[model samples]
Target: MFPIIFVSLGPGEAELITLKGLKALQNADCIFCPETPARDGRLLSRAADIMLQLDIPADHIYRFSLPMSKQRMDALNAYDQVYAAALSLHHAGKRVAIVAEGDTGFYSSIHYIYEKLQAGGTPVEQIAGIPAFIAAGARGGLHIASQEERLTVIPGITTADEIEQLIQSRSTVVIMKLSQCTDEVHRCIRLHPEYDYHYFENVGTPQEKYICDTRQIEALHFPYFSLIIIRHNSF
Candidate 1:
């Protein structure tokens, strides 16, 4: 059977991809890359750029648009759609790699794909990658968690109340996929004035930006590459 390798491209930088991930990309019979729509309707996501930076052949690269909904039905539907394509490609004896940003299993669409594949008895191998929050902590000059502190990684689409509670807790929190609920996240931050927040968008990339203050974020829309780290003093 052909191997299904799920590769994480890390947070942003092409160099951040693990040596093992690089080898997988180099050997992949076919690669499915995730692409997002830019503000001008252009395509982005930087997988192609990373491949070029590594001098990998682009002949086997394929772009797959990932959906943003969290509904169970929606997730299952999208899974069915993407997995069917993956299944077909796999059956053709293709050693396929689905390149995801950050860790493949951490708050990624790859989980949905994994579930569907497991249900269908399809084999899979998940190759880990450096996560964005870890990169963010490094860029911000702060450790995410020490031995005594709790850590929480929350999706940005989580309810404001849920976020508020997490932020006010003693845990070191990493909030991801904040593009959809940037405003809500900001409001939650505002409510908890004691916490220090850092925002990083596309960390380790040329387009990377860091914001420390919530007021500075006046944009009506959040960048798809954004993540927020909330640190409490008690922790």
Candidate 2:
């Protein structure tokens, strides 16, 4: 059986895919792409978009749905389905590629699929891509860190207390999946007004937006894939 590879499509733009990831997509016999839950009456699949932009043939691609719920059983069910589909394709002698929005291993659905494949003794490979926060930082001309500085990444679903403690630290903080807990995050940030903050939505896509002013954070409607980066002044 051919190996199952997980390819990162980068933040959003087709060109952001790593050279290795590009080559994997080009060489794969079949590609499995995630279909995200609808937002504002629209379903957006960054991996599928990238494949279309790369001119990958429709016949070579397959779509799999992943739930947006926080329940453990729901996540397991989704991963189980994805794993079965990919494994079947792999056993059929097709080199399968699972395309993810950002880096495959970072808070990505592909990670769960990877674990399933690994546990089943399936041969698997991963290609790294630029994560959302890094891409967002570059767009705003924000230096994430320098010598002796620290960087911390927290999921937006984390507790307000944890967010407060992390923000109080000297590390440059990047909060992923900010769409789910905007109110709590906004409250946490308001308490740390001394830090410089930037909110990124749809980083690298045509609809990409950045918020530099802290006041605007409460006013804007954040998308499902948004993130916030905070640079402590002391750092």
Candidate 3:
């Protein structure tokens, strides 16, 4: 049976890749990576450096763009293309590896590919890796959650109103994808002057940057691979 291995690239650190993820990539017959054309740039490119260290051939690495606009038909069609590519490769007796950041199971495109493959009765395998939350916590010296604290994780793209509401109610909130919604997130942080907030970007990358200030950070440059932790006090 051909194995479709979903490999997590980790939070922009080569050492963060699991031993299993590295082994699979070394033996992979075909590799698939996701692409995003945000004005800032692509997060997967950081993973590409790992692939380079392994000296994988350029042709062996293929990237498919994830639809970004509000075109559902085109988006679904793109997903179908990903499904078709993997399916075709699996049928050819090749072990396929799909790469994602953090872990494949957490907000990874591999989930979409996996569902489609399962529907077609394909054998699949998953290799987990470190998540961004862990790395963010480590970088900022913040503990993620305690037994008594309810962890509320919100995507950074949430509307200003929704973010304001969450910050008002939740004592501990972790926000992901802060690079895109910096201004809104900045505003939300200001509403609570007494709390401690940490804004970390590129959590484990060489270019990682962070700030632990309640004051609104204006035009604070942040990488797309980021997480924000807001905690009121000890839980």
Predictions in order: lDDT: 0.79, 0.84, 0.75
RMSD of each: 2.8, 1.9, 3.0
Please write out the lDDT profile of model 2 over residues 1-235, one tens digit for every residue.
6789999899998988888998898899889887767767666677788889998887888887766787778867877888898898888898899888889998886698898789889999999989999999999998888897888998877766676677666677888988778887777667767778899999988989999898898677677779988776776
Candidate 2 stretches greater than 4 Å from native: 37-43, 159-161
Q: How far is candidate 1 from the true structure (C-alpha RMSD, Å)?
A: 2.8
Q: Pick the candidate with the highest lDDT.
A: 2
Clashes of 3: 0
Clashing pairs in 1: none
Please give, for residues 43-146, the per-residue lDDT of candidate 1 as tens digits.
87587778778887778888766554556675566556778888899999888888887898987766778777877889988889899989988998888888
What is residue 23's positional error in candidate 2, in angstroms? Answer: 0.8
Best model per TM-score: 2
Model 3: how far residue 103 lies from native, Å: 1.2
TM-score of 2: 0.92
